[model samples]
Target: MPSLDDQPAASDLHHAVLAWYDMHARDLPWRRPEASAWSVMVSEFMLQQTPVARVLPVHEAWLERWPTPADLAAEPTGEAVRAWGRLGYPRRALRLHAAAVAITEQHDGVVPDSYDDLIALPGVGDYTAAAIASFAYGRRHVVLDTNVRRVFARAVAGVEFPATAVTRAERDLATGLLPDEEATAATWAVAVMELGALVCTASSPRCGACPIADVCRWRLAGHPAYDGPPRKAQAWAGTDRQCRGRLMAVLRESEGPVHASALAAAWDDAVQRERCLVGLIDDALVVRVGPESYALP
Candidate 1:
């Protein structure tokens, strides 16, 4: 439970971070100066739990189709879900569509400038909302995603990691690390997050290339090992999440509708397949076209 005082001063860390970012930042689409707020928002949503390589093409195609929240809201949910091909989390498609609709109706197709307003939209949780607000709107906020949290926990707290979920104390600590000026703070948050993604990765971190390595408390303490139990890996091949993804893929490929039997073909286990299909329909990721046909919604 180390505190900020026990680590390098905030100013030192900020300077190191900004300097490192300027020299080594990746050439990402969303990070471009010319990228629009809507494009940034779309990138943020797509990048969640997905890799940068997978998100690049999808983000480009998505923006090409619906440049604004109003443009997406104008289309059917099926089209949105269809465009979300193989992104792993299909529900995010529905939620992103819902958020677009909300933005179109409430904010006149514009991504909101305020953090509170952005958070009110569907699927825009603390991380997404803070990202949108800071990166897109240039507003000051503590953007604590898994990467940022881990970086800070190790660098400042000398702990191997933060909690599985962010806590209020983490939020407060993140906010404190922010610069006094709004613009600087926004840049710092992005830089730190990028640093974590590239250098301080979850496994086999590149400490040699880390910008703040010289002053990081964790490094000073000899990079002590994480003593916690190993995290359990979620099953993918024969799980409900896999079944849901397969069913959505079928609907995505089909223009009009797909037979329920067709979806059952995705899995061999009849009980599990049936259960997954029903869950998708119940979750509004898919809709029953008729008694036996289903389509993405």
Candidate 2:
């Protein structure tokens, strides 16, 4: 097994993966030089647990309507939720709206460049803060998303998957592998993430196409299967999430508030429908305007 302490091997891995990225990186609008910091921030929010193809059109429409943080902030929160358009997690829209309001009010309508400032925004966590700073501002920071984590698990630790939650050890490994120069480190972070997304995918990793296949510990170790605690499976049908989506879809399509009967027609289970409606209200994704009438908020 190659040691993590081996600087020469680490450098080789970096160079090989980065060279591969240079050749194959997707020309995402958010990654382009012309993309604003707001554009990158929006992409990050929309991309969470959502596929790129699904997010692309919505992202384009969103930017077209509200080109800046101030523009989004000027609109009603309900407008934000309506614009979200079946992204699954509606709360992300609320949080994104809140973050936009913050950026407009606190940062003069500009996405903050500093990690601390970015992290201070609503819904911005460690990984997000680091990613926005590095990817948007070209700042050097350790940006470990799921793909990056899985790549590290297989290539460096010889594990099929990482722990369900990130550990201190994983953070340290990412930090250690970050390039010294700011620009190089920034590019390296996204490069590794791209490699993971394109080649080292979760279910069907293309190890044969990987740049560091020669040094991949998991491949060298015979591609052992993951034996960690069972990963959470996402259930859709009959779930509250689906119920919520159906109800939200009704509200989104309607120009005015929908009656309780309209919402009841969307989902058959009266109890689950009512429960999810209340939950959405509590989550501030929905608002009640009249007796038994609901609308996006």
Query: Which digits, one per residue and each the tens of the lDDT, describe model 1 over residues 1-297?
Result: 444357678998999999998898898888899899999999988988999999999999998899888999999887888899988787788888999999899888888988899889898898999999999988889898888998998898777777777778888888789999999989998999999999999888899998788777877788888876677798878778877777778888888888877887867788988898889888888888798988777
State which candidate has the highest TM-score: 2
Give the Cα lDDT of each candidate: 0.86, 0.91
Index of the highest-lDDT prediction: 2
lDDT of 2 by residue, 175-272 (tens): 89899999999999999999999999998899889998888888887899999999878898899989998999999999999999999899999999
lDDT of 2 at 212: 89
Q: List candidate 1 stretches off by more than 4 Å.
A: 1-5
How does model 1 score by TM-score? 0.95
TM-score per model over all chains: 0.95, 0.96
